[model samples]
Target: MTMKTSFAFALAGLALVVLALAPLVLPDYWTGVLLGMTGYVTLATAWALFSGPTRYVSLATVAFFGVGAYTVAVLNEVMPYPLVLLCAAGIGMTMALLVGLSTLRLAGVYFVIFTFGLAELVRQTVSWWEVNVTYTMGRYVFLPFEGRHIYWQLLVLAAVTLLISWAIGRSRIGLALKALGDDETVAAHAGVDVTRIKLLLFVISATIITLVGAIQAPRWTYIEPSIVFNPTVSFMTLIMALLGGAMRLWGPLVGAVPLFLLFEWLSVSFPDHFSIILGLLFILIVFVMPNGVLAKFDDLRKGNRA
Candidate 1:
């Protein structure tokens, strides 16, 4: 194998070992934090896989995530957990394919607005269905699983997401994605098959995001449209990807750790002012590291080499 591939395999093994041992030794609170952060990391990583290379700026994380959550809520008791995840993936991929075909042609602000609007549409539709058809506010999903098991499950999912992302980053498809992002018309003229690649990446991203949502569903005792469809998840996913360095493989994981910690701190210590504090921090990150902190570091390393 190539040195790069070998290094990647070594890192994956190391991460697996760490994740496996973490829940056993850490306190319950820390294990829970690991679980939550891993979920967000998976979301950010999945988003970066598509949005970073293609610059699509999707706001549909909440929509796909909520779909998976609601799927679990509706099917948790009817099927095994593994089967429920497969169902969630299928539904998410179907939604992504339809959405991608419709909106992938649009560019810039129109695309962003469409995605954001789609999230709102899904949220509203779920709310309406809950009130009218289901006649309920939320559903209770009883997971007969332990906290450690959940943590390990999330860790495995995150690992798989990262591996796929890394493979894409190194392959020819990644080159095509970058070219398409730079200039879709030119890339298409050069026979890059822009439409097919973007749609494939979108479906892959949606599948991973939905799977994370499905796996995390039972973490909450009650699942509601309002909770699962919250815009905060969408916003954070984008922010984490940008903050960590969207172009790099490790950016989302690096960004998710500190940001998640800060979010938890502000939410607990200054709940009323959490938004204000987080907003200010986000502004600082954007202003200081527009291409992401990882990109800045990469630039510095390149300069040093020169």
Candidate 2:
């Protein structure tokens, strides 16, 4: 097998081995941390699939995520849990369709800003629903769930997200998206249907995120604007993708693990300055190693010329 293929297998094997042994080896607290980290890794990977390949960074990546979480959160009051998940995916796709069509008309930074604003608008609308819930509002939304159910559901969500990302990376649409990313004008001229391709990716990516959000809702058993619309999601996803090396399919995992460990440490040891330090590290990464920490593994392995 080729060296890259070997490396991929080795990495996968190593990850599997660690995961298999971890529960038996680690403490309960640490297990929880790892589980949460796994969820974050899944999110990073999902964002990377669209942004990395397309080079069209969508800052509103969490919009669909929020849509999914809220759909289940509100619906769980009436619908079954499984149906909530399906509805979450549907909500994400619907949001993607609307946002993609509206913002796809814009170019470059404009598209990013438009989507960001669109996400903000969605957040505000959700907030408005609270008024209806309390008194002026006509409806109320609440979700009742246990913590463990959410945790195991997240595991399944992560697996599904990973599988979809892998399939997309190897699929015809993925190739088209990659091409459109490399040269939009040329791809469009070539009859590649650039808008449709991006829209499809938007929907698929959103669907995955929504599934994750649905899983999240049960654990938190609550949903709110700031958390759902947090800019941190964009930043964290960016950091993970950058660390893992955007071009490589496995880069998000490579990036998120170390960063997340550091986050856990800082949060535990120096809670006060954690955010500042994390922010600085991101700047440092951008200024020093723009390609990402993990994507450069191959470079580090190269020897001097004879």
Candidate 3:
């Protein structure tokens, strides 16, 4: 293998080794932080599959995530875990289908606005549904509290997410997606079905994300509207992608962990001042490392070698 390829494998190996030991070595609080960060990995990796390669910015991650969470909650309430997973995946794909049909016709900011609106609608719907469910089922509306199993479940989610990312990064579709992302007109002239590619990616990414949400609900042992539909999840995913340099194999991992840890530490250390500090940090990171921290480091290293 080439040096770059060998380096990538070694890095991946080192990450896995650390991750395997994390459960046994880290404190429960740190493990929970890691688990929380894994949630962003699920969303970021899913978002990247289309956005990173196809240049489709989807802010509807919260919407898709909410749909998946609700699907899992509803199905698990009535059916079984495995069936709930399938149902959630279907719901996610169905939402993606509807979104692609309606908005892929538009370009640029219009497309983003439409998806954002769709996500907002999902948030409102979840909020309304939570109240309705509470009224309908009274005390039994939510799941009972569970323990550390949630982290284990989230580990599975991280694995599944990484697998999808790897597969898409190696596929012919990945190349086509990159072409479309770079220039749709050129992609179309080259005989690529730009619309079909976008639609297919939307569905696939949504389905994968839905599976994560499905597993997440039961792990949390509860579901609420705000938690399920929060745009914080979407924001964190975006930040993860940007931090990792969007298109790179392990950007999300590098970006998500540090920022997530920072968030937790800031929140604990400064409490009231944490939000403003984090806000400043976000701006600083983006301004200083527009291509992402990894990209900047890569350039610097190459420059030194030169």
Candidate 4:
């Protein structure tokens, strides 16, 4: 590797080491906060993996995330934890494949609206099944995982996601995705398999999101369609990714940390108005920093150099 590449790897390794050791030293509350932060970091980064270069703006994140959580809730009692996770991944992959095949052809706002609707459809379907067939509204997850365990798992997953995103960003597929985002017609004319590429990335991103939900299920202890399939998850993932400038590999992480903390504070301090504040923040970010905070920073740097 070149010097710059080597330095980046070294820095990433060091950061991972530090994060890995954090739960061991931190208090319970802080560890929980870190766990929440790590979860969003993974979600936002994975969301960006497909939406960033492709500009798909998916709101189906909660659909797969809820699937994973429910998968674990349904099977955790009978299967080993690792096997439950594997099953969740399989189910998530299948769902993503089906959704991607059906919807990848639709672009722009249609795709966005469909994805948002997908999460609601899944949530409502699950709700109906529970009420009509299962005679229950929720399932309990009784895994032996503590907050620290979940934190470590999320940290590892976040690191893996970052590595995968970085790898993809350096690959030929990345170039095709950027081109596809710029103009789908031109990209297809240039011989890029637009449909296949979009489907592949969407599946990968959705699967990771599923795994995140599965791993986080134990933290909730009790899972229901409404709780696990919250639409806020989708909106927050999008906002965080966009705020960080999803086009860059590390942009989601940059946006997730501070926003997650701010969100936590808002929920605690202004529980009644948290949703209103979140909506306002979303509007502000879209209007003032449409390209994201990182993009704005880049513009400033370029201007200074000029």
Instruction: Please give the ranking of all candidate structures by lDDT, highest first, separated by commas.
Output: 4, 1, 3, 2
- Report the number of the highest-TM-score candidate: 4
Taking the tens digit of each residue's C-alpha lDDT, what string does model 1 give over 1-306? 899889979987997898889988999999988898998999999999999988888988999999998999989999988899899999999999999998887775677888888878988988898899979888998889777888888899899999899889779998898888788899999999888998999999999999888888888879998889888899888889999988889999899989998888778899899778877887888888888978888878889532
| Full-model lDDT for every candidate | 0.88, 0.73, 0.74, 0.93
The TM-score of candidate 4 is 0.97
Query: Model 4, stretches more than 4 Å misplaced?
Result: 304-306
TM-score of each: 0.95, 0.85, 0.85, 0.97
* Candidate 3 clash pair list: 244-251
Q: How much lDDT does candidate 2 score?
A: 0.73
Clashes, model 4: 0
Best by lDDT: 4
Checking candidate 1 for backbone clashes, the offending pairs are none
Cα error of candidate 3 at position 230, Å: 1.4
Q: Report the Cα RMSD per candidate.
A: 1.9, 3.7, 3.3, 1.4
lDDT of 2 by residue, 91-208 (tens): 7888788878887757858777876676688887888876665334222345454444455566666666676787787788878877887899988888898888777777777777
